[model samples]
Target: MMTQGTLVDATIIEAPSSTKNKEQQRDPEMHQTKKGNQWHFGMKAHIGVDAKSGLTHSLVTTAANEHDLNQLGNLLHGEEQFVSADAGYQGAPQREELAEVDVDWLIAERPAR
Candidate 1:
């Protein structure tokens, strides 16, 4: 059973840009995206975790270029009293697809540099 709070996050799974298969072509499912000062090519793994237990409850994957916010709706289980995420998900509550979701959002703010 899942808890009342859910934590969501995404990570970039780096892949080599060089193609090794017989086709000699890069993976069609992976794409390049810039993070900080580096460029990464691969897929992004979006995960939803049970806050109380720290166990994963959901997962979604997309091309590296996909925005983390795009997968927020799919990571919810509909039973959460609150949802927590990093600064990448800052506007989750205002996203049209999630407008009707009543959970309290605990999105983090980007730290000042």
Candidate 2:
């Protein structure tokens, strides 16, 4: 019998939306594929990882070209109270988006220059 279990990687990543070309940047999928290479297709998968539980609260699979700040809103929309991510997720709009949802989002600041 073919075993088809609910393999929930939990952090697999967001799915894709369209084919990439020159004009388009981000897509519905989280990853993208490149051309010519053996393993092509480059994609970006937005993910929200819980620091303590390592649970994926939210995930968005957009094109690799998608901005972290742009996708930051998706993470904030999750039920998690606090979230952590790289500097790519830093910005004003993201903060406001989180605040709007009444979610206590805390993004660590980079050390002083």
lDDT of 2 at 76: 44
lDDT of 1 by residue, 15-100 (tens): 88885567887788899999999999999999999999999989999999999999999999999999999999988888899999
lDDT of each: 0.93, 0.48
Candidate 2's error at 75, in angstroms? 2.2
User: On residues 1-113, what C-alpha lDDT tens digit does candidate 2 reach at each position?
Assistant: 11111111112233434555577765434454432353334455666555555555667766554566666666543344445554444553346554665444355576677
Residue 28 accuracy (lDDT) in model 1 = 86
Shift in Å, residue 4, candidate 1: 0.8
